[model samples]
Target: MSDDLEILLTNDDGIRSTGIRALYDALSEHANVTVVAPASDRSACGRSISHAVDVHEHDLGYAVEGTPADCVVAGLAELGPFPDLVVAGCNEGANLGEYVLGRSGTISAAVEAAFFDVPAIATSLYVPADDETPYYEFDVTTDDFAEAARVTTFLAEHALDAGVFDHAAYLNVNVPLPDGDPAPIEITRPSKRYEMDAERNGDAVHLTDRVWESMDPESLPDPEGTDRRAVVEGRISVSPLTAPHATNHHEILEELAAAYRSQ
Candidate 1:
């Protein structure tokens, strides 16, 4: 990478979110940080990108009228000073588990950057998942993001020099809401447990997961070194990830195809 690293900063929480601003303040200290994000909250938008988008220059940076993925695309393709690294989020909520990764707009931005061959990091804050303090009910102010900002800045400053991205395309980082100066960082993998629950109403089906209501470290089923386990135990979680392309090496599929051709 270059000595003067160019960092592309984005988030699913939109351009004006405290998460993004906190990230900018921290990252700008070490790199040429450019903020390109949705104009409004586009949480859980995943990697969906529109064919055409409208971008407006704002005081903070460029606001794109699109999803998190769209912001990455526009930034890498059209925005100047092509980034050496792409950092997404400081998102309002935790994105843990293999299943949740695909649906998270925060992680999606990093995935998009990986396809562009740029190393990326997706960061999120883990609000206590409880009934009264529901994940969606918590408020994340700029002050609450100090710990995340610090870690993100630290990684951005040193990861490349450390060759952390040599084999990984991107990293997914989730920080628990600071208890007291935050906790230690742990290398983890996405938890495999699936927690989506659904109930049928008279005419509409309501899908929900009561998992958040019982997120205490002692109550969770997450194993010792998983992302969910780490965050619930008050540790920051970092999962190295890759954006995989399909391969035609399945023998079973090949046999099935041969049978169909014979028929």
Candidate 2:
């Protein structure tokens, strides 16, 4: 399995990010891996792409001065060997809910790979806020991603032969921070719980995602089998997802189109 596999790796975090490096080290042991990632942190940068950008050589791989999506495009089309799979991240924070999918650079990179007809996995670390230290302020080193790297490497090695990609284009994986033991892996769907709040004060509108504030394991609003629920409860959440928006036939739209021709 190690000799035949080639994995194109990229992340929303910059090329030098410890999370990506951990992934590079772990996955490399099982497959030929290349890292073509943004030169700087391009977090939350959806599917935005760069038409023209600079690329530089790095010890890991090529560092692109562009977004995560751009890194995928460049990796697949240029710098890397056509890969067996595209693996994005080991990101610093979780990309959990359905609402965050469109905004998360980690998910966006996986979606970009899906568009190319390649199986992909986007991995993120769900860091819970401790009583004394805030999650946002917590500093995670490369060593912290060992569990995530181990699990991701296992999936990368076996998911293809197990028919995982035949069911969905990509997998969105969120793992809790390594605590007592490696977390149990759970198959889940992206949680639909949304708590976006906007307040106007003077000329400024403060936007907040209250979901982050409500991640108590004992009192979480999310039900079982949801990505948010699993991660908060110390489980690895792997959500099988498809790229591109799903659409359905609409009779109302068809009637409107027919009536517009007469006008």
Task: Name the best candidate (by lDDT).
Answer: 2
lDDT of each: 0.88, 0.92
List candidate 2 segments past 4 Å from native. Answer: 130-134
lDDT of 1 by residue, 29-78 (tens): 77888899999999988889899999999886799999999999999999
* Residue 263 CA displacement from its true place in model 1, Å: 1.2
Q: How many backbone clashes does candidate 1 have?
A: 0
Worst 10 residues of 1 by lDDT: 129-138
Worst 10 residues of 2 by lDDT: 128-137
Query: How high is each candidate's TM-score?
Result: 0.95, 0.95
Q: lDDT tens digits, residues 174-247, model 2?
A: 99888868789999999998999999999999997888888999999999999999999999999999977789
